[model samples]
Target chain A: MSNLIKLNGHTASVAEDEWLLVSLPASEAEERKQAGKVVLFKLTGENTVTNKQIANTVIPTTGKVIVPLSVFIARKAVLQARISKGEIGVWLSTHEVLEHLIKSQPDLNGLPMMAIHVERFADGRIFSLGTLLRTRYGYQNELRAFGDVLRDQLYFLKRSGFTSFQIRADRSAEDALASLNDFSVPYQGAVDEPQPVFQRYNRAV
Target chain B: MYKYDEIDQTIVDERVAQYRDQTRRFLAGELTEDEFRPLRLQNGLYIQRYAPMLRIAVPYGMLSSKQLHKLGDIASKYDKGYGHFSTRQNLQLNWPTVEDSPDILAELATVEMHAIQTSGNCIRNITTDQFAGVAPDEIIDPRAIAEILRQWSTFHPEFALLPRKFKIAVSGTKHDRAVVQAHDIGMEFYTDAQGKMAIRVWVGGGLGRTPILGSVIREHLEWQHALTYCEAIIRVYNLHGRRDNIYKARVKILVKALGIDEFKKQVEAEWAHLKGAPNTITETELTRVSQHFETMPYETLPRHDAGFDTTLVSNPAFAAWVKRCVHPHKMAGYRAVTLSLKPHGKAPGDASSKQMWAVADLAEQYSFAELRVSHEQNLILADVKLADLFALWEKARANGLATPNIGLLTDIICCPGGDFCSLANAKSIPIAEAIQMQFDNLDYLHDIGDIEINISGCMNGCGHHSVGHIGILGVDKDSSEWYQVSIGGKQGNDASLGTVIGPSFAAEEMPRVIQKLIDVYIAERMPEEHFIDTVRRLGIAPFKANVYTKEGAAA
Candidate 1:
């Protein structure tokens, strides 16, 4: 069945059956039926829930630990030693690191989810980030981006990840939906999902 | 001088218009300060310690008398009647108003000059040996290659967004007067075993927080692949160079993180993709560029002018100048005359507007309407006729450019440190003045012959302190000013960074330290040896011991 995709308030194809809508909050995850809340499950900066949070409370051992981009090998080793052995998720800021991660971990797709942050929509670093996910890392799961997201950037984001985005309240649902028709062809490639432009051209022969 | 053709003229004119629009937007408040900062800097406009400084490009340190006159006119009209010649071979007018910059650039463009990339984190003005075409020992005229690279890299789309500013220097002679070792990329043309010109490329060499001698990655790259190879290296560097930390953003850090061999392999991989692209150098383009610098028809005269000899013999001061300022030339009659700006107690490499006008007139009268700014903080008339030597010397003496102190103790290569540059840690001009005052005699300077006393306000090496024979570095010690002295360094082909003698000296103790070092050199020299040659033979131990001895300590 088709689902209602409310991205920054406008409705488009939810693609819930074909593409997953990965999010971060537990409450947001409960509200949506098909969408999954893959909260950054790792300790970062001064904030973020740690292993101690789950140690005192009763959480499932099947959960994954989502690590920050700046997390190092030493912290990873400590985190693995402290928590029970489970699937690990790594969130990165740039495509170069994503390439390194994919090269190091050949079976990264088997993990539940991997998310990347586009810190600011004004910054073009996300273009490289998206390019890496699709071209280099070949990540199949939801490539979520937060912070300063807008409707205009969503088109490129969709081509790269085929996932949903979180945008600011000032951007209306009408403008967000209008931007989806800005380009017909995929400017970039996505993993496990061939863009309509690419598929039509390739199968025409 | 290389005259601008239709394409060059169009680009410059379009750039001028673009800058005028940017300036208008900035003045009208459409662009905020944060947004306008990089825009202004990219146009060679700097909000300086006092006022906005306009830096104009002196492409490859080559300028015609007409260009110098135009620069003087710009300085006089828009600035405070002066321009400073920078170590990177550009000229900066320190007091130009923000409104006057577009007019200044328009004025410069009239003479086929533009300030593009003079201050931005882009490919800066390409520099080469001042004696590129005139040096007797030069194997090829590096100006041809310098101009080619300058044209290719100007406004290049792919490599423009580098992590940091990139500097490239070309040297035809093995002597390396261009200081190619201290640049981001250094290219030198050398004849291979087959007697064909091959380019030797050096990468990751820069003098800053970490001064590194670039490693030679490609020994005998064909001349046709110069641009493509350089573009490949920059492409790989731009895409991979670290940008998280500004300090760790240079290609040096990348080369350090990945070994030079690995960097070379990556560059080769990139070059393999770009080998036949539009960026590749074509023989037609090379010849077109080379035609601009082909040697002018020179009239050969006597090797030595009897008039110059008579004047030298008659006037002791003129004799001293002739002995120091004149250099041997490969041409039968031409001689390279060095106009030392390092007067007894003046700023190094600073020619006031008046001095600039004087040099322009002298170049027109004596030389072939050409002048060169050497990396050694001196101006050179590269093609002076032998017959005009005496007349030029007399006129130069009147304007104070004929300081007969070339290569002497007073010939100091200094940078405008804390006084001008915001990044400088210590004031360097006063230190240079102090040393110049202490050693004012031509006779004494002649005694302390051929010693390079380079001073920099900081470790950035703008003054080339690392390559000085007697290098002086200003350091802050316990909130007080101090200088660190180094010995046995050399700049040319035998380039080596100076080794520090010992602990740093107080600012007051520097002159005494220099005296003691010179004393050691005089006492230990093995007959007729130059300062660098003697230092190499006796090593820095004897000089270091003398300079830092407890008994030789300052009272």
Candidate 2:
């Protein structure tokens, strides 16, 4: 039971007291195998890995099994049971994975900080993702957005629930800081204020 | 006329300040162009072909004399000393600079107006009958509800970035003067069994590349649930509407794809969560909004006026103008007069700065300081005294606002086509001009009687060609502009899209095509039949055969 278990041409082992991260590769699954006490999996592209295959390979052991957030959300019930049993963790790469997970699982709270890449800000997904993570899912972990973050979008990002932002190399933090107060009044619900403008009006009046 | 309360005033002022800051940031290079485009559009500033066009909202088509003067001042100061009243009942300044937009908005705010939500993928300016409160057939005034919707949708957060623009039209009568069936959301106000006002809701009606008449989703919805029901409909469209194709993004496509019953089911399911929400209108709030549009005080007088009767017979032009332009008002001793903006040789709905000032003065003198912009691209003095018809006609005639061709063949509704619009496929104004010149004889026009000749530069249908009795759409064929003629479309209560007559014709041949259609009408019409009636009586066969004939084609 303590030795490496080989199933369907994939190899993985359970550590005694540490978490394991697994990386599922298409053709070189044997070459990229980690022999460390903690193993985490980074599944990329269309692979043949199923929820049952990952579960069978990782379960019946004591160590923590970390998987990609997208796979975790897709197999939430099976992974959530493992997470509650202190045998699983999630690794996230994009905001969409977190948004879907939080929206589908309301009881999910306190996600571990994950690397967030902000590729486009004009589509308003960055703001909405942050809003859903904080307001709807009760996410308490630090949320970060990186890549081409402008000073103007910072105002919306912070209000929507971003704790930290990786500004571009050329932009200054002071310029970004000044934009947080761009609009004194916002018309929507956000992490900091959960009431819409109309409800706020009713309360004030 | 709904006056702005303190809250409304504060909201407009705050929006001005907010936009001023946004403009400053963009000018200083802090905000990128992509990030600033939607914000600027929400403020009604569009980067057109030649210059920036700023559209100002005229809520439910109502304007005060003071507001009109403010518009005139802005037009003269910032634009090319003129403005165009659009078919959506808004005003567009065709030649304003982007930098001066904030100042223009500030000027508008002073007169209880702003450019909020005039353009963008948001709920646009709410439209209603130009004769909302004064029409004899009206059950209740729709302006109160239109005003409420205006406030409710302003800067609505969830609906700000919809897949496409949304439009709402309210009608208080069965006549459908506001073209309610052609809007994104059409509300028909009526009295229920308990004598309380209720609304019949219609959804997904729009005219774009696809022309669809809306279907009734709810037969009788209580009046208080208007806002919440609208919210449910919008949220469903915003979240599920197509974002892949720009042309297929309107709610009409969504409704069509899901089918009306399934769409209504989804909307009702969503409404289940928002029905009793705080946004629901209360009696107090209803009364508060309704008080703003209460009937004005009028002097006690007989229904008939001898002075009005004498003026009608004394001058033939005045008699013709009264017959065509004057509309019956619900109130005794009062009438609604449409000041025609469709004078010959001029672009329809384009008002010069001097004409704006003149109309403002006329409204102040004869219509209790109120005026309206009709969806027909004309202006209305809704509360004019019957005895003041002759005096008002003289003033309107001198200012080029009296064409006496309302509801007639030459009262054309045309879009600012390839000349100013970047999206036009061909030129529409010149086509309208040619047709008006060809039918310049008022006697000939009056003999033809009550024909709506709507022209659009493209299939966007800004001129509402789909509902025009004689619809002319400009198409680009082989890089040359060609006109496609359609006939027999009727608007009012029996709204129907026009049928294309035949193959396309050259721009120079539009007048001949229209003449041939009118000649067919004259030849085939029954006694006392209108143009549309004749076209409906005999199908498009006669007209199509006559227009494509060798002699008709060579004319």
Candidate 3:
């Protein structure tokens, strides 16, 4: 059975009955996950023993395991373990990491998932990166935005193809949600609304 | 002159209500100052050094008698009984309280005016020739297109939070009286070989810390594609323009960084998606807007008025005023008169409430109840009959609007510097006043002939010092005010940025330095040559030597 598990204040669905094994902090994984939610393992460093453990614990079914890109790149055996189990998802902090992954793992084109970390001041850069990633690299997974999300900037953030935002805990979620509808009309193209206002108006006319 | 219909009226009315609510929330502590600053600025309210300065947009500088009277009334009621006409052809009330801005805006809306997109990062008030429809050299009336652009840019959701402020100017005449080259986007209208009206579009031109003339991105764009093309350009800018640095965020910087060719290619790529869109203006809509700017009901008269000729010969003062202030009109007996605001020892553009009322009365009595605010911070009665020159001059003189120094040394273009603006490095009005005092003689000014002295308090170039024939910019050195002089700049058809001469001068020494520069021009000027031509021929070398010489500096 699949169940929702919280990791570092973010919620993700995990398949425990399947062969998914998440590589994150063990304490956070244990406290946030229900019994038999998923396999939780700590990635202290890149070693053959951890990879062997990961390889032995896998069950053959379609599932996803979330792990940082550093651990995935360090241990090729661990990557093979995740690949043999099901799909592999990686958390990214910068464009450098994404570039390195693309160059290193060409066969993981349709197999790998991407989640981008965004800063408040780096919206323009992240937006541009998201555009190139989708249009040029054929990245189809739902892109996630993390870190210091403000309500006023949600409209622009969402327009840039970020499907999920890890909003700050102190902020009001309702206010942030309402901000998505603050502007009834937009003047340019975006992921949520691809047609510019002029095109829509012309079609109506 | 485009009358507001129900839709237009609703747009402005809703904006006013929205701003009023914003003000309420701000006062109740629901919004922080940081949150409320951009909202207020978008509505044309700026918290200045002394008080909140509210800028009221006078679209294309056109005004009716009733609107003029309403402005005067607002000046008396909400301001300090006066208003300053800005170089952008808008009016600024320098003493309004921030809380009172909503009330003032509501009052403005009653007269079919609203202060939308005046001061924020979005598109600003569209400007054009003061004598737009009536200029003799006009090939196509630009006001209609300007009005269309105004409507399209207002309350634009995506562009509201652009990287920086944007400005657009249009010119209908070949002479470039609208200073198109100094705007972010400059559109010049012309008839192509097919007898169809087309536009030449220039992008990335602006005056600020870095002054660059706009480069032509589209040499010939059909009139139908005007709005859509503009949308493409702005969208490209909004998505890709630099946001990390405020100083490097203007479209000019982006255009320069990308090169005009690459920028044009990018704009073309973006425009490919927007071509033939609904925003493309139709002939019916064009006619609907153009009809509002049709020629006034001008009475037919003889080409040569005997009384006008006689008045020129009989009254010296009237002739001088006519010579300096009157501009040619397309009609035979009609003339456009510039009412100079740069009288001796006064702020360049300040007009008292009584003077505003007097101009309104004059407009109602003559000139078909119309007035214009020129980009040089002067008022224009654009359709005055030639026969009424003497009477209009007398009334204008009485109202302190007739300085007879139009296009002369004393007719300065100055920004309200440290006195009002919080961003100013030094005071500018006193510099203008000192120079005006030194050259107060009208005959001497007329002899100097067409010397433009533009002054700005800072490098923001609000006074357009970059294009002044003799530009003066204020600089701060260790917290003390100093002035720098630049020579040989000109605005108009062949716009050029001025070249700054050597080191800075003290405030008290500016008048002396300017006098020395004028002396150099007098000594070297050929017969019938204007000040700008003389400076252009001689270059800044002679003037620099003359000003820096010990004897010249002491004088």
Per-prediction TM-score to the true structure, in the order listed: 0.77, 0.84, 0.81
Candidate 1: list runs displaced more than 4 Å.
A1-205, B550-555
Q: Per-residue CA lDDT of candidate 2, range B145-171, in tens?
A: 898788777766556567788999999
TM-score for candidate 3, residues paired by index: 0.81
- For model 2, the superposed segments whose C-alpha errors exceed 4 Å read A1-69, A75-106, A109-205, B552-555
Maximum-DockQ candidate: 2
The collision pairs in model 1 are: none
lDDT of each: 0.71, 0.79, 0.78
User: Sorted by DockQ, highest first, which candidate order results?
Assistant: 2, 3, 1
lDDT per residue (tens digit) for residues B7-48 in model 3? 566667777877887798789886678767777888899989
TM-score of chain B of 3: 0.99
Q: Per-residue lDDT for A1-205 in model 3, tens only?
A: 2221112222222212222334433222223232423211221122222444433443323567545555556555646866654467655543233455676555444454556555443234455445445644667655655555555545555665565555555555544565544455554444556554444544211
Lowest-scoring 10 consecutive residues by lDDT in candidate 2 chain B? Answer: B237-246
True contacts kept of 1: 0.00
> Which lDDT value does model 3 have at B10?
68
DockQ of each: 0.04, 0.07, 0.06
Q: What share of the true interface contacts does each candidate keep?
A: 0.00, 0.02, 0.01
lDDT of 1 by residue, B1-555 (tens): 677765566667766876786688689975567556666776888887667778888899999988998988888888778777778888878788899888888889899999988876667889998888878888878776787788766655344346677899999886888877778888988888998878889889887667677888888888877877887788667667765555766888889888999999989986886575554556666666687787866886777777776777788987899789988777888888999888878888888778889999999888888898877768899888777888888888888899998888888988887777766778888888888989888788887788889998888778878888888888888776788888777766667878888898887777788888888888878778988888888878888777767883753
